[model samples]
Target: MLELNFATSMNDAMSDTMIKENPFSSQPTTSAFTEESTYQAVCKSAVASAIFAVLGLSAFLAQMFMLLPILGIVFALLALKAIRAYPDELVGKGAAKFGLLLSAVCLIGSGAMHSFIYATEVPEGYRRISFAELKPSSRGTDAQGFPKRAAELDGEKVFIKGYVRPPSGKQYGLKSFIMVGDFGDCCFGGDPAITDVVAIKIQSDDTVNYGYGLRRIGGTFRLNPSTAASDEEEIPRVFYEIEADHVR
Candidate 1:
């Protein structure tokens, strides 16, 4: 009888312990979950706003090129969404508002710069010449087979109209330039037959949408006779050059 009593007591104790360990016995608590969500929202807003602000500044610096300002506007708008989501966070609210302001400044500055560069009359000494006027002797070849047409174009101002072909292979650089005519053979960095095509160097290091259709540009023309080669051999040649004081 004593042994049986002891056994029954042990079984009862075990059952009680199992009941306490059961997860369903306790009520669910969601305080942790709510806190985590709030923290994430605040962080997201702050980060997004900060990024937009930086992009806006970049746009301002490159406003002269018309590319940076446009990008800044886009990033600022995105930041605003994040800020609105986390209104409680001071950083998010500040950053979002700043980004919007920066974007606006970029747009206004870019427009003003464009007007200044393009609207001003070409200087008296700058003559409007054509591609046919370029001397054959001005063309020279570098070690990489890239032509040095600018040497022939020294001290001359010419205006040539052509399609803006983005640098292919290895020719694209930080500066803005384009190919004028369709060259018979497309070289690594340039098209040879379309000698009329020239690269226009923009004053600002701003990124722009170059994949769009052809644009017409006018500027004072000069050339530098130097060969720039990259690891890629088939880099197209950047010959025939124009310096557009303004691009339309």
Candidate 2:
């Protein structure tokens, strides 16, 4: 009887412990919930880093603002730390790796872009001029209404800023192309006025890739009355042309 009582007591204790644990219950434990939250945070960081990396590589958008790549790299590192901390709970390991790669690429690209922009510095003794000032007025537009400053710039070495459009659809190392004042309008297929565009002819046989943002070009300025030829309806062919000596 004593032996049977001891066995019964041990069975009762085991049953009580099992009841408390409640393996059949569907509710998640506090630890499980905490782990899920951690996983989500890790994924969010990874995704954010990836997005920023892509933005950093964007043509003009990232070029003007250098922070995108830096932030992307930072976030990617954070994501990696989180994933390593909770490997069992956190997902998106692949995403974190991809984010890191993209951020690195953008960082490299941004550096190159900065170097290029600095290289295109305007030479001393060149007067700065706007595209609007360079264009002579058409019949519908009055040349007298335009700024007299453009006339003064004629036959002078001038420095101008504009966005480049590759005539050959080449993104890098353009030997010849057109420049426009507004990048937003150009991207949306909006044609700029004749005065707002300039034909750029690079004399160097060594081609340079299209620069991001507003590029400063220094060269000889000439005013001539001629109609521009364009295969695209959105682009006007009539405008002032610049014989570019140096482009940055």
Best-fitting candidate, scored by lDDT: 2
For candidate 1, the per-residue lDDT at 179 reads 43
lDDT of each: 0.52, 0.70
* Shift of residue 112 alpha carbon in model 1, Å: 1.2
lDDT of 2 by residue, 1-248 (tens): 99999999999999988876998968787888887776544478888888887787763344555678788889889988988998866777777788789878877877887678656555888877776666554423335454355556558888888887645455687766778877764454556766777777777564556654567777787655455564334565744667788777
Candidate 1 per-residue lDDT, tens place, 206-230, comes to 3324443334455656554553222
Q: How many residue pairs clash in each candidate?
A: 11, 5
Per-residue lDDT value at 232 in model 1: 24
Worst 10 residues of 2 by lDDT: 138-147
Clashes of 1: 11
- TM-score of every candidate: 0.40, 0.53
lDDT of 2: 0.70
